[model samples]
Target chain A: MITLHDIGFSYGNNHVLHDITTDFHPGEIVGIIGPSGAGKTTLLRILLGELTPTQGRINNSSSANIAVGYVPQLDSGERTFPLTVEEMVLLGAAAFSRKKPWFDQSEKREASRILERLGILQLRNNRLSELSGGQFQRALIARALMSRPSLLLLDEPTSGIDLHTRQQVLDLVHELQTDGFTIILTTHDLNWVAAQLPRILCLNGTVTGDGAPSEVLTSQVVRETYGANMDVIFHQGRPVVVDSVNNGGNQ
Target chain B: MSYFTDPFQYDFFSRALIVSVLIGALAGAIGPFVLVRRMAYIGQGMSQSILGGVALGVVWGLDLYFGAAVAAGLSAALIYFVRNRGVPVDTAIGIVASTLFAIGVAVVSSSRDRRLNSANLLFGNVLGVDTEDIILVALVTVIAAIVLFRNYKTLLAVTHNSAVAAAHGVRARLMEVIFSALLAMVVVTALRVLGVLLVAATLLIPAATATMTFRTFRNITIASICLGTSFAIIGLFLSFHRNIASGPAIVLVGATVFAMNMLTSTTSQRNRA
Candidate 1:
């Protein structure tokens, strides 16, 4: 379990996150939903220890060493970086072994296994530029898994892909969560988050609402967070979100 | 061919060939990082700033290479410092490089030394290379090879995405500084053979060509080294036979290779489409 207490961050005089307190348990999937500039990426950076909060305390209860794996947003620059899928995945393992400058055969086998697990084994030798959006996402997931982290963080994994690919990626994340990996992902797709994720945290520079989708994803809460009117409907006991203006009329 | 063997008849020609090959390989190995990191302009800035150091050395009666190394290193450090202070990289590099280059020109104009040939310094004379220059180039080549070989993965990580690398416990700032310093060393060492006007081309063209022809980093690195060394040898041959300046000849050969690579890659990409 990891706990964040009163996490507040600022860049110079502009405060980004304020009084953010959250606890992440083992084997749970959490979705962070917010509009742009709501500090979603900033909060993820703080969790990954890339940025230190101005006022906060974090406690990790796991006895073993805590290793966190991060998957950043899709970067077009990395696609043309002249590295094969296998070599890119091996970079994740490089972070683990400090003494070995190059990956050994054992690390190669591990990378192959992760690629297999991610269902991209056939693309091991293919360059990153050759992979489609869905395949690239899978490859990035395999790279993150190379570290064997207890916590996995993904930032906007389904932003640019098609609807079918988005559903496939969400299914993969669900499978990982079922396999006992704690996952936290940020997204603006509230409908997908409500339908696929177990818990959602609505954020606008702070935690506006946090609970199961049915309890926290109300129309008023979403409007407060996103500054846009959204309609919330319960479809078979699960909240289904829709844009109020685009779907004909207000609720 | 007798054309190739004719240049090897003279000891000076052989030494110039050896120095060119060494510097070519070293610059080729280091060039990809500069290209991938989008620091090609920084390489240009460092090379141009070396003129200031050489001019200062001429005025003070000191070793010009040492002066160049100091000036280039200081400019690199200043660029790094300014980048951290929220200045954009291209703007900072421009400000520093032009200032140093202007100072170098001013110092050269005021100097009383009759033997300080600015044209020869700006455009290299391969035949003027001595044994000491060869040794220095060889030493720097070996050191650069070792440093790049040992830190290949770390450097790749930082180049790919610095924020992600930092998240994974890699010190991105330290790696940036180390790479900048290495770039400075290469620029300073390469000045004797390629000169300020052409060294940046030597550092960028081969790497750019390799990127067009290869799909993997290791292949790109190897291909860049081969291409750079070949251009150096061929350029030296042309210089010896055609009575042309060596630095321009080398840059021209590299440019031709880059054009060929671009043409072929475009055709292949069209075929794939």
Candidate 2:
């Protein structure tokens, strides 16, 4: 279990997260939904130990020794580097070495296995500069899973992908959950989060509400986290978040 | 023609040639990491900072390479410390290195009568390379190259993504510190022939030139080494024949080769498109 007790964070003088008390249990995919600049990334960073809380403690699983795998939204692909997909995925196992250089045969086998599992073994030799948005997202997730960490923290894994691939990525997360991995993700797709995630954390600086998606995604919480005049509609057996101010669109 | 009878007939020229090749190999092999890590600017900054150390060592009658190494190390540490202190690294490098470099210029200008030759340090008289120094350069370069080749994948991971590397259990910060130290070592050794002002070019130009044409990491490294060594040999010849400065001549040749590579790659890319 991951527990944050009285967690507070500040940048210089601006208090970003104030007294956040929450518990994230294992074998569950928890989705954090919030507006921009609402400390979602900061909360992830705190859990990943990139940023320490100013006034609280975090309790992780006692036996969880491996570092938390992170899927950053931004990648070095935006820069010009002729790295291949297999090369990129191999980076996930880079930390598995202690000394004496080079990865042995077993490590190489494990990396190839991950590539096969992700259904991208055919694209192993393809350069990362050539992958499509959805393909890149899948590759990033595969890279994250290479470490076999207990907790997977993703930051907007579906930000720029098409809807179909987004569902596939979420399905992949659910499958990993079935394999007993805990996924803590932040996404702008609240409807998908509402539909797929068992537990939802509505956040604005602090946790506004926390429960099952149907119970916590109330009209007041939606408007407070998102903007004003937002409507929550249940259509086609799914909760669709509509911002009427934006003229019947999610934006 | 008698001088061409046997290339190693003159021990000085042989030492210079061997040292140049070894230094070129060193720079070529390690340079892509510098290019990829976005530490090219910092390498330039550190090389310039070596001028101050060289000047001080000359004035005090101390070992020049030792002085240069210390100064470069201190400058690198200072850059990291300033960054850790919330100051931007480039700004700190600009402030600290430029001030120190300026001080070196002032000292060199005022102490013309102290029997210290600043021009020799700037342009580099490769004819003065002795057997001991050449052997030292070769040994250091070989060792460094071996380490780099052995740990190529781990270092690549660190360069690609420090966060992911750290997550996968790589000691990212420790690896970074080791990289910086090795860079300082490489720069100091390279300054033996290229001199303080032009050493960074020895490291950067050939790697960048190869990058314009090559897509694979391994091929880029090999091409850079070949180009760097070729430039050094040609530059040495041009300096000897025309009685010009070796350092400037080498850099000019490197710059020309780089421009040509850039032109060919751009035109080829356009044609493909």
Candidate 3:
């Protein structure tokens, strides 16, 4: 279990997070949503031990070494190295290999299995530059999964992806949660949050709302989290967020 | 065959041949990372900047490569320090390269009894390559090869994405420092073989050509070394027969190959489209 206690971070003076105390329970999926620069990615970075909190400590009470896997929201638009999709995925296991120069047979098989699970096994030998948007996203996920990580962090997994891919990601998240992997993700898709996420952590430099969609969501909280005039409406007992300004004139 | 084999029978040509081959292989092995990282300018800048160090070595009776290595290392540090204070990388490189090159020119012009030959430093003299020069290049090439082999994957991982590489416990900074140091050594070793004017040509063109021909990083690396070595051999032979400067001949060979690769790859890609 990993818990952040009073985790406040700042970039020299521009404070990003303020006392963000949260924890991820084992075998749970939590979706964090907020506007740009809401420290959603920053929070994930802190959790991954990429950055030390400027204020508090991250408590990982587990005595065992936790294999943490990460899928970034976007790859840099720069031309990536000419690594095959399989090689990119194999990088997930590179850290765990005992300083070996090459991936052994078992590791290669595991990579193939992860690629198959992500539905891009046939495209394994293709260069990363050749992958389409949805294919690239799936490859990123497959790479993360190659580490056999007990904890997974995906930043903006739904951004820049097709709706079909979005649904596939939703289904995959559900499947992974069932497999006892604790997952944390940040997204801008409120509809995805309402439809699937059991818990939502809303943020605007801090935790504005944290609970199930119905309990934590309100027009005030939505405005606070996103800094937009969007309003939430219940559709078939689930919250469907709509821009109130666009639909306000009709009502 | 005799015409080609005749050059190898001479001691100087053979020595120059060995140096150029190692330069090609080393440059090929390392060039793509430099280009992919967008450090081609840095490579050129550092190679030119080392002239000041080399000139100072000539004046003070120090080992040429030692002075070159020190100078390159210092220039990189100074540029980094300047860039950290809000200067752009290109601007920093420009400032450092010009200052050092001017200082080298000043040193060369001021000394009445100077042993330093400007043409040799700028254009290289392949016929002047001695056994010592061959030994120096061979030593550096072996070091570069061993380091590349030991940390190939991690270095490539960092090259892909440093943030992602960090997640795998690869220290990007450490790798960078190692790379820079090795590059400095490579440049120093190349100072007499390729000269300051053409180090980046060998350092980048081979790998750039390979990138178009190969789809995988490993194959690209292998291809780059082969291409670089071939270019060096052919370039040396061309220089021997055509009575041209070895450095320019080598770069011309590499440039020609790169141009041909670009032409074919683009046409093939367009055909596929």
- Candidate 2 clash pair list: none
Model 3 score (lDDT):
0.85
Worst 10-residue lDDT window, candidate 3 chain B: B111-120
Residues B94-116 of candidate 2 have per-residue lDDT tens digits of 87788767867777887764434
DockQ of 3: 0.52
Which candidate has the highest TM-score of all? 3
Model 3, B1-273: lDDT tens per residue?
Answer: 788888877788989999999988999889878878889999999998999998998799898888898899889999999999999999999999889988888897887644577877877778778888898889889988888887887777777777776765667788888889878877888888788878988989998999888887888888998999999999999988898888899999989989998998889999999
Model with the higher TM-score, candidate 1 or 3: 3
The C-alpha stretches of model 1 lying farther than 4 A from their native spots are A63-65, A97-102, A243-251, B84-86, B268-273
Tens digit of per-residue lDDT, candidate 1, span A63-155? 776787788999899888888999888877655555435788888999999899888999999999999999999988887888777789999
Task: Give the interface RMSD of each candidate.
Answer: 1.8, 2.6, 1.9
In model 2, which runs have C-alpha deviations exceeding 4 angstroms? A76-79, A98-102, A227-229, A244-251, B1-7, B81-88, B113-115, B146-150
Tens-place lDDT digits, model 3, residues A41-138: 89988877788889988887798866778888766542366789998888877666645457789999999988898789999999888887778888
User: What is model 2's interface RMSD?
Assistant: 2.6
